[model samples]
Target chain A: MKKKNDWPFILPAIFVVAVMTQVPFLLTVVYSTLRWNLARPDMPIVFSGIDNYLFFLKIPDFTVVPEFYSIVLQTIIVTVVALVICTVIGFLFSILLDHPIPGVNIARTLIMGPFFVMSTVTGVIWKTTILNTTFGWYGVLAKSIGLAPVDLLSYYPLPVIIFLFCWQWIPFFVLIILAGLQGISGELVDSMRIDGLNWWQSTFRVKLPLIMNHIRVAVMLGLVFIVKEFGLILVTTAGGPGTRSYTLPYQVYMQIFSASNVGRAGALATMTVVLTLLAVNFVSKSMKKNNL
Target chain B: MRANQTLSLQRTAQIKKVIKMVALTVTIYTLAILYFSPILYMLISGFKTEYQAVSPSFVFTPTFETYKSVLSDPSLYGYLGNSIFQVLASSVLCLLLGLPAAFALAFGNFRKKGTRDKIYMWFLTTILLPPVAVLIPLYTWFHAWQLNTTPLGLLMAYVGFHVPIVVWMLYSFFADVPTEIMEASEMDGCTRFQQMMHIAVPLVRTGIISACLLVAVFIWNEFFLGFNLTGNDTATLPVYMSRFREQQGMFIAQLSASSTIAILPAIVVGWMTQKSLVKGLTLGAVKG
Candidate 1:
């Protein structure tokens, strides 16, 4: 009777989660093996068996490579670069905001404002108001200095996207890391001061090691979200200027919606999941090594 | 002569400390303002007229004219209502499903020694699965059933994706509840539901509130699944904001106003959850 009670308590949640997430994911894996296209209804759906995966993975010509490879590379570049910057800069911001200055909460609140705003909004606001060529702040500032404004979204899509990713996500890093900083006991801080350790020594040698786990948590969560970011790229570049800014998620969107190839999209989606897990595993392993 | 020299040195030191404090305050405030200028400018631009927003000037004549125009558009209300409905409904559903499971995992008996940990780990891993993994199948199913024509389909997806998060956060909160109290309640012949409602819920009320708010914020801002899975009538605020992308810097004031409306609630709710969010996230992830 005691054991039976546990299943009843947990069954509803387990059932809903499985049906919603786990089951669909498994179906996606199955769909990757079939040849199905939404647009071509005349052709019957049949087993393709890894053809869809090969569509993205196969390298017939080594000279140029495929768009799939580039998209994957771009995704890696954006996620990795953004995450590195978010951690470093977010730590700096946390340290700055962690000071016991008056009205500090207001400053912290201001920094956090971007994280809560929807990504689509962030994309549009930056593109139109800040980065626009003729009508934006970038354009106006360049004109005042007698320099022509280069369209950043077109010219440097990856860097621009990385910058925006850092801007939006760094606050989240700060939020987690700042909490870790505050969790340090007052006695520890007093001892650091009493030892007459300079600012750099105290910050890098002592405080950083203590907050390693917090940084790990922030980075891991940041990785999961950043790797799959779609809305920002969509509203900003729309993976345009010849698919230079396309991330994995955006490519998956294109595969399904634009190409109307269900099987290929499924395959891409599955690869994306695999890559995410690998990155996550790599990060956790590295952080653990660092912790020791 | 020694006393006079010491007094003079102490006064100078006090003066130097005051100077340093003032310098630090100024520096911190300046950086904060600079960092936040983009959103600040957006908020200000919402008050400007279209022509006034044409340039990047900060000084502007404030007006309700742009806001009034944006708010009166009928389509805006459709997306807003959908967002509100999704946030409210999905948050409630997630809590109802997650609370019991978290309670069971934290305190209930399982036949196997590791069953509880296994189930909890399963939920945690599910949180790591990107939405794209499930997108294809759910899209096909929703399309076949024409589920996108109504808001129910998206709400169900939101609830599904978010229930894990709720459970993940609340599991830690439930674990913090003293088992002795629960055991005492059980000895008094109280049902599991009675103990949960009377003891567990009250003890972790803040956690529940934060989880609900966090889920609400996520559902509100969710774009990938929301965009792919929903139709025109069922689309949410993020979709509405995406439509402004093709405007090419035109309609600056109107765009600002609408986005302000779309983003305000999430930001407000997000602010409220910041305290508990850190606690829940760090506790849950670190322990695992």
Candidate 2:
């Protein structure tokens, strides 16, 4: 048999992807090492070594932590908390949703609604329509009970952002996890039931392990997405209240667009990518170990 | 007497089961509705006057005034058109570029061992690369080439980013196609193109539809690139939604109406893709 050349079929995708993603990413790494500033265009673009990275990494005073560290911490907290909540609640929701009940499809569809909505829209809606202390449901409910409504977005930005993240993402987790649950063979389920396995044993001991692969997929994909979410933070808190809610991506956006410091922005962007890949790798490794 | 007692016990157990089912159903519905209430309220709020939406009360005379006014705004059309164009154009382009690549990755033979896995993994890693990592270069390039002024620049970025997703999804879908059929067809003198177009595609028809829908939902909701890359005229609906941040408590009805227009398609498309989304995503990763 004549060997057909695969390059013809694959070249276009590789070319486009390389030009758009790979080459640009390489450029970003290069940019990270330069002293380019869009604001100070008069200054010549020159190699600056690791100064751009050190700007974020270095600490001038031991007592006063830099904003970058806090931002990274906040990002970690938000992503980790949101993922944890989404997994726990989403697993419960999936179990409830997997039952053979009439009109369950409608319920499932309703729960899946927010995952599809744009992050910006999610931010604006939840912020103004739900979280607004003056005219939101939270406000009305609070006032009806003779309690004052505190501004959650400003006062508790991380938790609010984390909550919203979980809300938007739990459906996704459920979607995948439920599919995993349903994919389990009926004979296995029947056998477990016949063996006098109670609800807890069946769910945690058997079903959970059976669906660990699905959970891992959900977590991995969710982490990849949620780690870099900028729109929600931009629209909700705008990384305000003293940079309390800023994530790495939001910080990167501010660095380039607001500060016009291209070098620092590139450095930050590179670090963000590194951190994301690290987190992903770590999660996959740990999950694999646990699954074993 | 023993038989009668057992029948009564069985009837009581059946009643208990019925009660449990009813309770579980109610809980599920309640949770679903509550989980969905924020979006539901926004949808319902779209039907109210600004004054009616001011107080967040569920009870009010619903009106289409807000929707009508929102639809009549000239500025909204630009962003809407851009979003629609980006979604349609990018989805088609992604399919065109991705289908062949995914087909080749699934079935094509490479010179080196593990080349196929390496390429596929390369595509997967690209999915993990957030838009910010490529934003700076793309931004500068777009500016230098004067591509930001036109829709094509953003469209190119969208296609570049999304093609991997399409490749990722369609690769899995194409994997489901039996290699024996392709081999047999090759023996029958059917070309690679014919085998892909006629055999593999039709076999994974649902996969193709779901992948397209999934990508459409993603590009529609994408904000990071859309927010930064486009100029005012070229901005998409996400940009429009972000602008609503300044409205605060004012114009609640208009905000709701506009957001409804923005998110409705994605929600519908997302729902459509739900069944196959897990299959496409997990089947490929879980097995390997």
Candidate 3:
């Protein structure tokens, strides 16, 4: 057999990926070392050991609300909250869908609507129409009932933003869990039922164990997603009113675009890169282990 | 006595079935309403007058004036055109660049068995980083090169954005092509490329379509990349939609109306490819 090298076919893909990904990836590391602020180009470009990383971490000036540590804490808080809501609600929805019910297809479509919505539009729809508090539906309903209109985003920015994120991702969890549920053998379920197992017992003991991998993957994907959630903050809060919604990804954007601090932005971007890489590694590792 | 007992048991079962059916319907519909109300309200807002948009109401006379104004706005068309151009170009490029790489992974012969796996892992890792991480540096690089804010830069970014998904989806589909077919093709003097073109590609036509649709939705809705990298002339739909919110502060009607137009295509695509697209999200898990 003639050994034709497949590298010929793959070269275009490699080139594209390299140009788009690898070059920038390397540049991120190298850029982090130099004081590369475009606003202050007169300053000679010199190696600044760990100054960039230190500045972003310490954040001496409190220009933004909830500087540095609060931003990181806020990121973790919102992501975890979103995941919790997504999984709990998604699990219930999946269970509801397990039955052979009428109008299920329509129901599924409705449940999955947010997945189709763009992230920017998602922030807009939530901020203006749903969570606006001035003319939003929630406010209207509250006022109609003679109650004080609650400003959710104003008072509870992280939770409201978390809900918005949950709305977008809950369907994802439902689909994944539903897929996992369907993969379990019907016969095993029937036999379990025959062996005197009730619905709760069967679900917790047999079904949960079988679908653990799916749940884990859903969580891993969700973590990666939350780490990258930037536009939602950009459109809605813009990290305002005291840095209540100031997240790390949003901070990175503000640093580069708003503040014109390349060194700090690069450091922030590097942190994001490490976090995402670890999450991806965890997902891939678990998947490989399960498959093997 | 036996006949009476049987009739009583049947009645109990019948009662149970009725209870189950009613409960299922209630749960399902309730879940649907809870999940979909936000979007439904957004759609409703689009049909109202500005005052009505601000004050949510069920009894107001619905109007299409907002839609009329939004559609007639000349810049809306420009934003739509930019969206269409970027989405179509990136999707096509994803197929062109990713399909071949997928094919290589699926059928490539290498010096070491792990070579394909190593390269494929590297590709998937690229997706792990948030778009911001890439944008922080890529923006600087592209700006220096005068490529930022250009349609060309946006296209290039989107292609990079979507290629990993394309490669992953296609790689799975191509791998599932029966090994026997490839073997037979080899026996019949069909080259690997010929085998891919004639057999593998046709077999995974649905996968290709699904990838295209998914990529299209992502590109069309992509906010950050274009938000940062591209400007008014090159910005896509979501960027324009946000601009409406920022510029026309209380014009809720127009913003929602523009958003409706922006999102209609994605919703249509979603309905069209619901099955395969969901499967793709789960990384090739199809429910049995």
- Choose the strongest candidate by DockQ: 2
Candidate 2 wrong stretches, greater than 4 Å: none
lDDT of 3 at B86: 91
Worst 10 residues of 3 chain A by lDDT: A58-67
lDDT per residue (tens digit) for residues A102-153 in model 2: 9999999999999999999999999889888888889989999999999998
- Please report, in order, the local distance difference test score of every candidate based on alpha carbons: 0.93, 0.92, 0.79
In candidate 2, position B85 carries an lDDT of: 96
Model-by-model DockQ, in order: 0.81, 0.85, 0.63
Each candidate structure's TM-score, on Cα atoms with residue i matched to residue i, is 0.98, 0.99, 0.94
Question: Best-fitting candidate, measured by lDDT?
Answer: 1
Candidate 3 runs further than 4 Å off = A58-66, A280-292, B247-249, B283-288
Chain A, model 3: TM: 0.91
**Higher-lDDT candidate among 2 and 3?**
2
Candidate 1 wrongly placed segments (more than 4 Å): A1-4
Greater-TM-score candidate between 2 and 3:
2
Q: Interface root mean square deviation of every model, in Å? A: 1.1, 0.9, 2.1
Residue B218 CA displacement from its true place in model 3, Å: 1.0
Put down candidate 2 lDDT per residue, B38-86, tens digits, no spaces. 9999999999999899898788988989999999999999999999999
